[model samples]
Target: MNKLVTFIGNGNMALSIAKGLKNNYDIEVVGRNIEKLNKFEEELGVKVQKHLMDNFDISNKTIIFCVKPANVECVSERLEGKARVVFSVLAGTTIKKLRDNLNPEGVVRCMPNLAASVGESMTTLTGDEEYKKEAQELLGAIGPTRWLASEKELDIATALAGSGPAYLALIAEALADGAVKQGLKRDDAMAIMRGLFGGFGKLIQEIHPALLKDGVMSPGGTTAAGYGALEDGNVRSACIDAINKAYKKAVELS
Candidate 1:
């Protein structure tokens, strides 16, 4: 029999993680609303045990804490007992805060983006070394994972991997829009952009991004023209600044 994993919230992040883990583990979701819990199960298309958040005992159960950062205190106060281990996906919430508040035997901070719904999240984790193997096994069900040495490094990674989907979404949207502006049908543009991104995803894994770009660009070709335009717009600088800003925001939230 598969081990049971419990989720402490039923929000988007919770649902996404549950989606990826459904095949590997039995799921139990605790939430404040019955309707939301039911909806979560329905959307997940799998049966799951559901419980109200009030006075829920977490003892001996592995927990995926998915509450809002601001509600950490209120939610922790409601949980009745110590969890065996807690893997938190709350952005900017510190392991010390989780340990102090929830009194879990082990605390791990995880940063997984929306891709978790499709088992492709670039999850990053840091916390108690004791739970390293367990964390890898659980979160790895969703996608590739990188276990960092320090909370500081994890926070920076959070800014990159955790918040990366939104950045890529913006770029993807802009690319499709640019193609549409050049007279391609909107649907065709979107399809082509998605295909381009899909292929790039594989190529990037095998080669440096600069090498990938160079391989595509020839002297005064269309690719070079487009690449030069992107450079002229300072897209690289903007991306660097975005990472810096996001990292600072994560630190501020802690």
Candidate 2:
């Protein structure tokens, strides 16, 4: 029999993961609003057991924690029952914190981005060793899963994979804008930009970044000229700094 997966928050992340697991699990949603729970059920394309967060029993049920990091205390205050396990998608929130606040048998810190909505998230997990395999299989239902050794490593992964979609989206938009500036039609530019990213995504998996860069440029070619401009603009350093800053923020949030 498939296990039940209850979501503590009826928000986007909850909806996303629910979408990925709807076919496999009996889903339940708990939130502050009945209307939102109804909406969540509709969005997830399935009927769900709904309860106001203030009154619910989680004992022996798997929970996917999607509440905002700051709101955790409030949510925990309302959870009257213990959970069998919790896979928290809250960035920077640690397992110890979850255990203390939520009273779960096991706590897994999970970092999954917006792509989880499409079953393509690059999720990272870490927590109680006994639940490592279970965590991977549960999260892998939505995307690829990486089991990191410690909370520190999971925080760093959150800075990378958890926050990666927004960074990539910015680059995609900028590339399309550059094409539009060079006189391409806006629609065409967007289409080509999406195609470029699509193809590059596949290629990137099999090729090293340095090798890919070298393969795209010849000494005095257009690729080399553009590459030089990116270098001059310090884009590489900026990207490195971005990861560092995001990682630092995750640590602070924890």
Candidate 3:
């Protein structure tokens, strides 16, 4: 029999994670709205046990908390018993907040992107040292997981892996637009852009980015001209600043 995993919300992130874990675990979702919970099951394409949030007992259960960070305290008050463990996906929420509010034996802060739905999330985790192995095994089921040494490191990773998808999406759209501006048909440009990203995803796993770029840019070639244009546009500095701003915002949220 598969192990049980309880999700505390039926929102998008919860559904994404459940999509990845449904085959490996029995799912139970607790939420306030019955219709939303039912919709969650339908969207997941799997039958899941459902419970109303009011006076719910979490005793002996593993919970994947997917509620908004602002609602953590309010929701915590409604849970009736201690959880065996809680792996929270709430961005910028700390383990201390989870432990103090949710009253779990083990608390973990997990940062998983939207890619979790596809089992390709680059998840980052940190929490009580004793729960490291368990956290890794549970989260690793969905994607590659990195266990960080400190919450600070996990927070930084949140800014990167957690927010990186949106950044990449902006770049993807811009590149496609650039192609269209150069007289390439919109449909063809989009197809080529998608193919470029798909191949780059695989190649990036095997080579350093610097090495890959150096290999591509021959003297005064198209790649060189494009690379120079990107530099002239201050894209690199903007990217660096984006990370710093994002990281600081994560800290502020915490």
Q: Local distance difference test, per candidate?
A: 0.93, 0.90, 0.92
Indicate the worst ten consecutive residues by lDDT in candidate 1: 1-10
Error of 3 at 142 (Å): 1.9
Candidate whose lDDT is highest? 1
Alpha-carbon RMSD to native, per candidate? 1.3, 1.1, 1.2
What tens-digit string does per-residue lDDT give for candidate 1 at 38-146?
A: 9999999999999999999999899999999999999998889888999999999999999999999899999999899888999999999999988989999889999
Candidates sorted on TM-score, descending:
3, 2, 1
List, in order, the clash count of every candidate structure: 0, 0, 0
Q: Per lDDT, what order, best first?
A: 1, 3, 2
- How many clashes (backbone atoms < 3 Å, residues ≥3 apart in a chain or on different chains) does model 2 have? 0
Each prediction's TM-score versus the true structure: 0.97, 0.98, 0.98
lDDT of candidate 2 over 196-237, digit per residue (tens):
998998999899999999999999999999999999999999
